[model samples]
Target: MQTELSKRLGVEYAVFGFTPFPAVAAAISRAGGLGVLGAVRYTAPDDLARDLDWIEAHADGRPYGLDVVMPAKKVEGATEADVEAMIPEGHRRFVTETLARYGVPELAPGEAAGWRITGWMEQVARSQLDVALDHPIRLLANALGSPPADVIARAHERGVLVAALAGSARHARKHQEAGIDIVVAQGYEAGGHTGDIASMVLTPEVVEAVDPLPVLAAGGIGSGPQVAAAFSLGAQGVWLGSVWLTTTEADLHSPALTRKLLAAGSGDTVRSRALTGKPARQLRTEWTEAWDDADGPGTLPMPLQGLLVAEAVSRIQKYEVDPLLGTPVGQIVGRMNSERSVQAVFDDLTRGFERAVDRVNRIAGRSAR
Candidate 1:
């Protein structure tokens, strides 16, 4: 699994696992792959730093990184409340009505949903970035595209390589031109905010578009054969996020969601702009259907949309409202029927890649190297 990009990052393999759980992230690195922790869920700098501390202590001298949802431009004074206030009353009413229809109850008075996606908020992102840069991180990836020039420069100054997710050749080119160190070609089949193209079509295009720069193939990939396919398409590595959601280390906190994911097929997931203002692939549930409804108040964009649905999601998950419960997941959910340790998954992936190589060699009438 050694690739130029992987070697450049001082990792044994080119597999880059994107996960939110620190345990899972550290496990990936210990298994000889890069584990990029997702930092968007951390609303406080102290919490993020705490997790990074734990990851480093558990990684056994291996490298790790964190992903954040930072906007491309600078917005110094825009607070989360300011962004929340931008959401229209109609959207608020719609969310309230939808929750009521689902029979999801409000949280006990004075009780707050502990988690919210705060990465899009500038203040929170900067705090997260500050905490991340203070660590011994090998990479800092932006999920919302290339970070602002100042952010890129700061990461570079700290000797931290920067990566950004790209969906199209055009976006890849822009990242390359903007000094991005790596490009993760996330396709429409990916879990979170993604583009319209599938990995089969997007990976090679991104690789060709950003020649010499590393491209990590993402979306609908969860196995060794899939990894081989990504390499065959010219990707330097693979970026896996959805694959870890079902792993034992993942703390989804809802058994219902885990059961849904385990039982789901490729078609059980849908791409809807219900989670965020932008279109993202997630599980098909009443929650998604309501936002996707023709007569429903149209979905809000980005931050506003996230705010509009955050509380509803909290309540749904808190009560495990079966019909209204869902999560952002990719098409790869089909093959994730079992919960295994991260090392077990890596071992299977390694074995699978070797088998794929042997099969290809046999087809070419050549002995396995």
Candidate 2:
């Protein structure tokens, strides 16, 4: 389970868990893998700083990382007002109408919209990254594309490793040229924004493209066998997100958790731009279906589409009864049928790795003799 990255990070395994919940991040770090807190949900620098403080305190001195979304392409100089102005009346109407059709209730008076739609903005993501660098974070990861050269430089200046997720060999080469420390080769089955390539093909391509620089295989990796497969593809580690959603430390809502348990299957998810203006894999729901409809207003790009659905999603979450409610998850969700402690999940991964190694070695030994 050890690799150069794991050795550097002082973890027992190279199992990296990426979650929106700090508790989950801290738990994964304590359980001997790198836990990466998804910082895209944090709109304000102060809140992110405060949470990182908490994670540092709870991590028991284990190294952890932060995940931010900074797309390589975005509307430059687009302020909040500018982004808001771009949302057409037709798109707004479609969102409202779709919610009504789903019987989604309205937000109660004075209830805060519990989501951030503009996290993809460069300014906000950089602000969060700046605040993160002030802490003891060992790693900084960009989820969408190669981080700005200055951002990568600043992280390196602070002795932080910079990692970026890549969906293709070309993307991985971009990271490699940009002086990134690691590239997470994520496949189409991964949760959240991903490219069309599958892991089986993408991993080795990225591995060779970014040779000497460590690559983490991501996407559909949810078990020990999957973990072994990642290593076989020359990945130094595995980056997982969806598998952690069902863990006890996850901040998933009870209703959504129940839906994940009862309604989710490997084939029950869809990649749609409705949630974030990028095709992120999430559970198949009426909300996604409505957005995908040709009759509805087509989706916006980047922060705009996310802005359009932010309030609607907040309302759905608050009501907790809408069947249309869903969250970003990967195809591995089908295997995540039970709620378990972070320790239990880690134990399972370790045991699975051992069993897989034993089986492989036995087969090789038979052939050798």
Candidate 3:
């Protein structure tokens, strides 16, 4: 699993683990890989700082990173309330009707929504970046695209490498031009927000498009064999997200959702705009179906769609609405059949990677090392 990127980041493997939980992030770093904490979940600066403090204390002197979701250009003067105003009355009616039809209960009296929608805002994301740069983070990545060139320069000034997620060769070239140190080729099969290209076609194209810039292959990767394949495609590393959701360290907060993920096959996931307004792959549920319905109000874009669904998402998870309850996940869900510790998953990946390498060696008329 060793590669130039791994060695440069002081990790034993060229695996970059992206997860929302601090425990999982620290565990990945401790397991000889770079753990990147997704920053979009942290809307408050103090909360992000607090979690970074925890990761630093528990990371065993290993390196970790932060992944923030912000648009390439700054979005100005767009408050949450302003975004909320843009949601049509029909969209609101649709959400209300869907929840009522599903028999999903509303939040209990005085119960907070349990989630906030400010993380995607430029102001909030900038606060996150401020806290992250103050920490000992080794890498700073943008989940949406390349942050402004000034942001990249800021990361470089602090001696932290900047990376961005790109779905196409053109996007990779853009990131490279923006001075991004690395580019993660996140394909259509990936969870959360992603693009239309599959990993097989996207990875090599990105690697070649940004030659001399390190590339991490993402999407539909969960095992050592997949890691080997990533390297064979000229990737300096592999970036993974969905494979971590079922880890014992993960806190998905809903047992029913976990069961749904475990039971899913590669064919079970669909790329829909239900989760984040963008085309993101997730479990196909009645929720997605409603939005995808021809007669229903179509989904909104970016912050608008996110704001529209925030309360409904909260209710769905709070009450565990079976048909409407689902989270972002990738096609790799088929292999995540049971809960396992982060360490155990890493062991499987390394062992599988070794076997894959040996198989390849034999195929080339050589013995296993």
In candidate 1, residue 57 scores what lDDT? 99
Query: So what's the TM-score on candidate 1?
Result: 0.97
Query: Per-residue lDDT of 237-324 in model 1, one digit per residue for the tens?
Result: 9999998998998899999999999999999999999998788999999889988999889898777788778878899999999988
**Full candidate order by TM-score, most accurate first:** 3, 1, 2
lDDT of candidate 2?
0.88
Each candidate structure's TM-score, on Cα atoms with residue i matched to residue i, is 0.97, 0.96, 0.98
List per-prediction Cα lDDT, in the order shown.
0.90, 0.88, 0.90
Segments of candidate 1 deviating more than 4 angstroms? 73-77
Candidate 1, overall lDDT?
A: 0.90
For model 2, the run of ten residues with the poorest summed lDDT: 254-263
Colliding pairs, model 3:
none
Decreasing lDDT order of the candidates: 3, 1, 2
